[model samples]
Structure formats: C-alpha cells, structure tokens
Target: MEASELRRAVEAGRATASELGLDVDDVVVVHDSDRVALHLVPCGVLARVAPLGHLAASEFEVEVARRLADGDAPVAELDPRVESRVHVRDAFAVSLWTYYEPVGSEIASTDYADALLRHHAALRQVDLDAPHFTDRVALALREVNDREHSPELPEPDRRLLSDTLGGLGAAVGTDRADDQLLHGEPHPGNLLNTRRGPLFVDLATCCRGPVEFDLAHAPDDVAQHYRGADHGLLHRCRALNWAMFSAWRWRRVDHMPDRDHWRVEGLNRVRAALDRCGPGRPEAGGAGTPVG
Candidate 1:
C-alpha cells in the first residue's frame, strides 16, 4: 500500500490498532520495500503491525536476535535493554519491540567479519548438519533461469543470462542435504543499527541450507552493500553469489520495469563480478560456488 493509502486505512477504521492488539493511542507507519506496517502503542506498550507473508522475514530476525543476546552468537545482537514480541493476526504479523536508540554507529564489514568468525567458531561446537548448498543455489537459479525467455525481456539479455546460468551450473554442481540454517537474503537493509551494534532485522527467508549460499548473496548486492576488507571464504562466496543474482536480474524484466530496475542493476553487477572472476576461479569473480 502507498504511504498515503496505508495511513488512510489506519485512520478510517479499515485497520484498527485493537485488531492488531495495539493500544491505538500512538500510531506510526514504516515501509521497507514491499513490506508495510504500523508502529503504535498505548502509554507503555509499542508494536508494529503488517500483513502475514510480509512479516515472515521477522521470524529469522527474532531468532538471530535472541541467540545473539544469549551470548550464543556475536553478530551484533539486539539490545537487551528492550523487550520484543511478535504477533501474527489473520493476514498480518506484528512485531512489537521497544524502540531502541542506537548506541553505536552502523555495523561495517570488519565488524561483520569478526562477528561471523566468532559465530562460526561457536557453530563448530555444535553439529550443524545443514543441507547441501546446491539446493539453495538451484532454487535461486530457477527464480531467474526458468524465466529466461519471457518474451517481455530483450532477447540478447535473455541469451546472456542463459549462458551465465550454464556457467553457474557447471561451476556450482549440486547439493542434496538440507541441514544448515541460512539467512537467505542478507543485505544491508535487513541489518539495523542499534545500541548493541548491528542488529539484523529480517529473517523470514532463513532456511536450513549450506552456509555458502547465504554468503554468496553479498557481492551480488554490492551496490546495496559493500564487502569492505574481508577477503576470505565468505567474501569469495559473496562474489559468486552476485553472479547468480545477475542471472536472476537478467530474467526479471517482464513485470514492472520501474520496480525491477534495481534487480536488473544487481544482475549487471553480478555479471561484472563473474567476468572478473572468470569460470576457473569460482571464488575470483561472482561465480556461484558452495562455501564450507
């Protein structure tokens, strides 16, 4: 819903705070991409309300936050100073959290690397029999590959994407197991700057799969985020992931041109990463390769 429309809905009784268990005394609307919801409460309560599927991403985010706060993981956990709750109502899911004031600057790549390394270190202590990375790669690949010839897309672009996927297939191979849980979409936007450091916000796409698949999405979205100085396995995986994103973007032109532009740009970036890395060094450019 447009900002105006959502506000109108909230005011017209079409969307009531009580319906979402909100007190309705104070109300605010927040929109991120395709998701839209409200932030409101009574004297001491605060909550965010949005449609069901739109809020699914919150699932993974809350889990990650909880783990981090418990000292089990270290990727900038949410502040313990506030309490949070998630509510699912009919077609909507509302996450009510004590709005926290940022205690630090935005999380940078170095911070992410350190946190991720520690997280993996702790993960090693447990048996994370995650699924084969190939499953996710294949699913992401299909989101773009199957739509290669959608008459609406330019033929040359389609051909280039097809070739790119062909290269990805030969390089990534396949995976069968589905054990490791991953934040399927890990962009800067999903991360929030909070008192604790960088609190990750969306996790609706978290899936049990190989860790490499999660990392690969980074470089693919370089425009949306920067990898900074980290150049290890995760970085390599991120580069290759961009290549896959390129393939996906190249195939997404049929629907809304204005809306799909960013995806297209992302795909182009992945293509650039692939060219730089080449087919041989799956880790060099943004070629899809499973990370361990």
Candidate 2:
C-alpha cells in the first residue's frame, strides 16, 4: 500500500500508533523487503513499520513484541524512551513499530557464538501448532509426493522430496525433546547490527518446533554471508535446510528455477542425516536401503 494510504489509515485509527501527544509530519517509507519496512517521522517519535507478505509469519512479530514487553534480556531494541508495538496494518500482513537509532552491533564481537546459543534457547517460548509449521510441511509433502508430480520432477528434486518427507517423519518420531521452540526462520537478515550488540529483528516466523527445524538455518552460514567468516554449524544447517525447505518453497512457488537446486540439496541432507541415524529408519515409501 502507498504511504499516503497508510498515513490515512493511521490517522483514521483504522490502525493504532502510540498516543505520543504530538503532531506528526511526513511519513517516509523505508523499503526493507519488497513489500514492507517503512519510517514515519513525527515531531517527537520516529516510527519504523514493516508490512510482511503472506510468506512471512505474523506470530514472529507478535513474539518479538511480547518478549520486549516481558523484558527478555537478549532483545536489544530502540531506546526504551522510544517505545514500539506490532500491529496488523492490513490483510496483506504488516507490522508497525517505532524506529530506533542503532547504538551498537547486532552481534557482540566477544560473545557472538554464545549469543546465538542463547537466542536459539529463547525460541522455546513460541506456539508450534497455532502458527502451524508442521501442517505446512505436511502440505508440501503431499503436493510433491504424488506420483504425477514425482515422475516429472528432476532426479535431484525427486530424491530431495523423498528424503525430506522421510527425514521429517524420523526427526519428529525420535525427537525426545517433544516440545522444542524454534525461530522458524532465523537468519542474519532478521538480526540487526545495533549499538547494543546483535539485536534481533524480523520475528515474523518465531514459533515452536524441533530445534533442528530452527537450527536448520545455521547461524554460521548466515554469519559467513554477512561477515565472511567460517562457521561449521551454520554451513551444515544451511545445506540441510536448503535441501528440505525447497520442497516447502516449491509447494508455494513451484515455478521458480531455484526449486531444482533445493531438491538436490535436500537429497544430500537426507544422506547426511541417514548416515548419522543408520539404516534403522524407514524410508518415506515402504522401500529400505543402507543406513550409511
């Protein structure tokens, strides 16, 4: 939506903003992604609003606000003096929050690794079913698993689909940690480089699931992309998720060329996981194969 339309919405109270007791000036739209991220400058408060598309989850934004309100220690945000809130702007899915001047980096130089561990640890607070990641996975599997689609799929993608379905079933079945929380889509882009050190943004996909599902993104890979540093964990999970998530993404946007790569990568992830778990696990179909 246009800034003028959004401004009118805010003015009409169709959307909510802080009652800061001040008159506002012009609204500046800051493009973070294709559809969202905007800046609104008033006399006193500067607002940063992000309107997410359907692909992004609203629960993540809600969780961020909740955590901030709860005073979750790790979440460094704008100055406390400048408060923020997450509100739905439209059916298109947008989060309206205030802008905060960066005080430091998103990741602490001395404590980056520890901060990641802690951040992953905190994801346990989200809802698994309400946000419904598992259902999404299941739907993706159903779409590709059908014989009509499988035969037409490239060899790499075919195997990737077969493997992802099998792997998810195995992970859930053996997951002794039944109720693990996850930052469904944690990545470096979601994190902000602020003055306070490694502040997290883009809580649009914060929900509960297997830690592996969240860790699947691999912080090291994101770090490498952003900082050009080596991180084994990040690399491993990046590859793993690349393998698996493609099936899900394909289910949503099947026409994309990247789907081919995702399928191949997924097969590799399956191979790695199977090597670790051994042949004891059953395949997605009735067929059996070597564990290693």
Candidate 3:
C-alpha cells in the first residue's frame, strides 16, 4: 500500500489523531510489506496496519507485550496512551506502538539468549487463546499442498516438502509433551536493540511449544547460552522451522531471488533431520527416514 493510501486508511479506521493523543502533523512510511508501519511525526509513535486476518495474532502480541511490560522481561512496550486494541477499517486491522531508535550495533548472542529466557518466563504466566506449534506446521502443509498458491515450487520439491511436513508432524506429536510460551521466531531480525536493551518485537508468532521450537530459529551461541535444551529436539525443530519457512518462500519465489538459496537450505536441513532421526533409531524419536 502507498503512503497516502495507508495514511488515509489509518485515519478512516480508528479514532482521530487528536483523540488518540497522536500528532498528525506528519506521517512517514517507515516500513511496508504484509504490514505497513507509519511513523506518526512529533508523537514518536508507529501505526502498524495489516490484513484483518492478522487481527487475532496482532491482539495476541499486544496482550503479550502488556504482560511483559509489567515483568522484568525486556520487550518493546506498546504505547500506553494509545489503546492496543485491533481496530478494523475497510479490509485492514491497525494498532499503535511506541517508537524506539535502533541500537545500530550488533547484539551479542548472550544478550539475546538471556532476554529470551526472561521473556519466556514472563510469557508462561499469561494464558491466552493462541495456536499451538503444530498448528503452524499444519498451516504450512496446507500452503505446500495448494499448488496454485505456490506454483513457483517445482513439483519434485513440493512433493518432497509435503512428505517431509507429514513426517515432522508425526515426530513432533509423539515426542514433544512439554509446552511453554514461545516467542515463535527469535532471530536477529526480530530483535530491536535500543537504549533500554535488546527488546524483542514482532510477537505475532507467539505460541505454546517446547523451547527447542524457538531455538531452531536462534543462533548457535544463543542456544548454547540457554541451558538444558535437548540437542535432538533442537535439531528436529530446526528442520521443522526451515521447512515451514521454505513453504512460505515458495509463494514468493517469483518475486524474491534470494528465496532460491533459502529453499535449498531448508531442504538440506530436512535431510539432516531425517538422517539423525530415521526409522528404527529409537533415540531419535518422532522422525523417520526420508521417503520418496
């Protein structure tokens, strides 16, 4: 969406800028994608708009942010003055948040690991209606099955992914009994290092699952810092994460040249997981050898 169209949408969708205690003097497009983020000038607030289907996920993040704000967990807090409710306008859902300057320096893995642990602890205290980790895999499987949506994916790779996802589903279902609140994806892209500290953003993927699910997306050093993580589960989760991400990229491969590399990387991870957890290896629980 264009800046002008986004501004107009925000204006039409929610309370007036004055009522919401925002400065409407200037609006700049800070980021745009599936979600459009507008920087509300002078007020130092960001207005994020997304499709109405994202309403549930958006609200879930807001609630998680609220909970984290009260705890010692480091997280980007929602704008206190502005209500965090998902406001629906036309075909979009909007929410307001406080803007923070990027720290600019690379965040150390230890920092991310410690912050994630704290955030996970805080998240465990809050009970909200959200999808389980398996739901994510199921969603990805549906996308992989929908050839029309991801026509860019080769027939061979698509079939491979479909079979891989099915095996992953069974493996995760049988082995993972412990569930905890997860950040869903805790990679560097989602971390905003600010003056306060490395505060996590993009909580739309929050769900209940094993910590390994989250670690799959994190760096090795970060995972090392996080004590008591099961190496086997972490490996399995890594493959699952890669597969789901590859399914998403399959739909956008036409527009994203870099997606080809990611697709290969994801497939490689799947192969590794199968090798480690192939059938008859009781130690590898939940995964079987790759089958054509």
Candidate 4:
C-alpha cells in the first residue's frame, strides 16, 4: 500500500490504534514490498502490513517473538500492550511492533554469531508448528517449474535447478542428524543493531532445519564461531540456499531490477556447487560427509 493509502487505512482502523495505545502523529513508509512497514512516530510503533492470507505466518512470528522475549533472547520485542492478533483492514493484515532506532553500523562477525547462537538456543526451546526448510525449497522449485511465473528463466537453468533441488533434498534427509529450530535467514542484513544490542528482525522465515542450514546463510567467520558445525554439511546447505534464493529472485526478476545481478551470481554458484557434488562426480560423497 502507498503511504497515503496506508495512512487512510490506519485512520480507518483507529479502533486498532486505540487498542494498542498508540497516539499516531504521522506514518512514514520505512519499507515497502511484499510486506509494508510503516513507522508510526510519536506513538513509537511500527505497523507491518501483509496480505490477509498471511495472517497465520504473521501470528506465528508474533508467537516466536513473544517466546523469545520471555527468555530475553536477542530479538525484536513485540509490543505487549497491543494484542498480537492480526488486525484486518480491507485486504491487508496489520500487526503492531515496538519501534527502535537502527545503529546503521556493520555488525562484527563475532557479535553476529553470538547473537545468532543465543537466539537459536532460545528458539529450540519453543515448540511451534512451522514449515520445514524443505517446504521452502519445494516452494521455490514449484515457482521455477511454473512456466507462467518463470517465463524469464531459461529452460536449461530450470532443468539444472530441478536436478539440483532433488539432489539437495535427498542429501539433507540422509546427511543431517542435528536438525533443530533455525532463524532461517540470519544474515547480517536481518540483524539490526539497536540499543538493546543486535536484535534479529523478520521472524517470518523461521523454520526447523539442520543448524548448518542456518549457518549456510551466515559469513564464514560467523559459521566458524558456531563451534561444532559440520563444514561439509554447511557447504551443501549454502549451495541449496543459493539455489532456492536464486530461483526466488528469478521469479521476481521482472518486478525487481536489482535482483537480476544477484540472480545470475547465485545461479553461477549453484551450478558450480552442483557440478562438484553431482552424481558421477568425485565429490558426490562430500555432500554427506564432515569436512576435515
């Protein structure tokens, strides 16, 4: 929704604002895409709005945030004053959050790793029904296979992605023995350095998977600090991550100009990783083994 439209929606939903004890002065569009985040200043609340169909996932995130908050985990805290229930305004589902100022500095690998490990530990204690990591891979594969949605992807790359996803899915089932709760995508971009220290945002992607799957999205130094991570599994997970995200980017390439570059780079990485461990390759066994 545009800022003007969102403002009107917020105005129409004054009952929601009152329920949250928010005295909204103004609404600034902080981020706009599949989800829209509006900064409600003076009220100090961030309103995140997504499609109405996303209510379940949005509620899941709030629950996760609530659990993490109880344990003092390094994650963005949900506003307790407001019920975390999804507020429906027309076609959009809105949720309110406590706003914090971004530090705007690059976080160190050690700091990022520490926060991630702490959050992961806390997440392990919470039991919530979330999609498995493979579900996401399957979704990406479906998108790639959908000719109407992915007309931009070349036929050869689509075949490569299908084959790669199949191999990676089988490898994950056979290789990973330490599957657990994960932050899904704990890269530096998702870690916001606030006064409360590095807090994780965007809990929408939380899933159950190999810890290595989470590390696959982190920097090498961050992964190294996550002691006992199987490097070989991490490598395979990284390749799978690249393939999945690459497919997702490709699916949206027509809508996002900047994604074109990253999509190509990610596809190249996926191709290289697949070639190394694909059937008949010397490194085929490497996918299931621990790195020396």
Clashes of each: 20, 21, 1, 0
Q: Give the C-alpha miss distance for residue 87 in model 2, angstroms.
A: 4.4
Query: Candidate 4 — which pairs collide?
Result: none
State the displacement of the C-alpha of residue 150, model 1, in Å, after optimal TM-score superposition. 4.8
Q: Which candidate is the best by lDDT?
A: 4
Candidate 1 local Cα displacement, residue 262, angstroms: 2.3
**How do the residues 166-283 of candidate 1 rate in per-residue lDDT, one tens digit apiece?**
5554454444242355555666655556656654445455555445555555433332232332334343355446645555444544233353664556556555655555436433
Question: Which candidate number maximizes TM-score?
Answer: 4
Question: How would you encode candidate 4's per-residue C-alpha lDDT over 1-292 as one tens digit per residue?
Answer: 5567665555534436665677877777777666777777677787877777787777887777877777857888766677766687776678888888898788888888889888888988887877789988888888888888888877767776776676676678564467788889987767889987899888989998988888888876788788788777777787788788778877744444478676677777775666545453223222321122
Per-model CA lDDT versus the true structure: 0.48, 0.48, 0.74, 0.75
Per-residue lDDT over 25-113 for candidate 2, one digit per residue giving the tens place of the 0 to 100 score:
55554543324454445632333443444424544454465664453535544324433444454443434453555555345434544
Better of 1 and 4 by lDDT: 4
Clash list (residue pairs), candidate 3: 171-286
Model 3, which residues run further than 4 Å from truth? 1-18, 252-261, 264-292
Name the runs in model 1 displaced over 4 angstroms. Answer: 2-24, 41-50, 53-69, 74-86, 103-106, 119-136, 145-151, 163-170, 173-179, 208-212, 217-236, 243-264, 281-292
Give candidates' CA RMSD values in order. 7.1, 7.4, 4.5, 5.1
Find the number of clashing residue pairs for candidate 2: 21
Candidate 1: TM-score? 0.62
